[model samples]
Target: MKSYIAAAIQMTSVPDLQKNLVQAEELIELAKGRGAELVCLPENFAFMGEEKDKIAQAEVIAQSSEKFLKTMAQRFQVTILGGGFPVPVSTGKFYNTALLIDPSGQALARYEKVHLFDVNLPDGNTYRESSTVMAGNRIPPVAPTKELGNLGLSVCYDVRFPELYRHLSQMGADVLFVPAAFTAYTGKDHWQVLIQARAIENTCYVIAPAQTGNHYGMRHTHGHATIVDPWGTILADAGDKPGVAIAEINPIRLEQVRRQMPSLQHRVF
Candidate 1:
């Protein structure tokens, strides 16, 4: 994998699909302008609304979201990760899916979110993602790109589960993508901490795109789209705003850290 710049895009997506797409395009353009070759959009970059409203428009959302990712990737001539969108499933529910598209608009990898967010926050917000999203049965895939390193895919709440990332690392992942629309209540404390831990433990670069600001009524997200190196250092952070966190993903730095630490090589279990 050659060295390249990656961008984690932060956005305030709402119920309007077109508006969200426009916002995502603008951010992607900004990232590309900043020399980002691998651009990632946050979860729900297409649409974020009530569960009922989302399910009702699931088919439309799925089609439009996939098409948008492909179009953007081809247009920008850069690899893009559309962090989480709804894909209709056989169970009449949808899978929370993350997709990777290459510069030629060809799909490289896809992952359905395995872990669901089902929690009641102290801030008077409750999320039951399983109600609308079908949990994926299979483990996420690591797409080995000739230029981008082995890219591992996961979405949102999966950051809380270290075993999944361990599995990715075991599969030879050099970069992990943890795109999320994390709740404002839980994010202030857990978000960065969890991401850094995953990067440190796995000795992989983490490119995390995030949703920030209020989306709909009573739905606000903590926004700190970030990129961390294998050393668990924050290379770039877009703090609580709609923007891109651009950082260089260097193979030399990755190998240097791995050699210096060698923790992953000493794993006993």
Candidate 2:
């Protein structure tokens, strides 16, 4: 199969949804210009605030998300992997959603974040994503399209669980999407290692977009959006800045790696 390029967009989102969309639009254009056929965005790329605060921003997504992403993808003729958005299902509760838009401007796949970040950090920051964000029950592998290859769709906290990636790889995933807004404290130590490890073990490509820098309030993230190859090579690394990490995804290389190791086929249990 022929090789193609993908992009990972890093951002620092605030409380304003419009402003974040504008920034994302510009970055998407940049990725297109870089010849990125598939572009992924970071988690919470729309609005980042308290659980109750996101609900207020949730109602507008159903309309704006499709309209805006569809237009952008169709115009660019590139597959756009939209970042996480808040979709309200009930009063004061919403699911963190990730969408994949085809070049034809249709949402081909939508995967809600299965794992939520609910923990206390060394910096004394406590995040209870379950309080407002309802976790998704299903794990949908992004079906292969003519433009983009087979992808396993997932969100930020999901990367911590290798079992999920193993299942995805077994399900015929050629690539993996791990869009996250990793906190500064944890990311500083564990981010790159985990991302590379996933790719190496699964023998599949990994595309990870991230939120970087300090936000509207005291919130901060370690923004190192990156792409990894099947052999655990760091293909592209977007340093702690709002930018795009562009890299080529070669199916030939993926096959070569898998053939060399054959670990997936040798699994006993």
lDDT of 1 by residue, 1-269 (tens): 89999999999999999999999999999999999999999999999999899999999999999999999999999999999999999888999999999999999999999999999889888889999999999999999999999999999999999999999999999999999999998999999999999999999999999999999899999999999999999999999989999999999999999999999889887
User: Largest lDDT belongs to which candidate?
Assistant: 1
Q: Could you tell me the TM-score of candidate 2? A: 0.97
* Clashes per candidate, residues 3 or more apart or on different chains: 0, 0
lDDT of each: 0.96, 0.88
Worst 10 residues of 1 by lDDT: 120-129
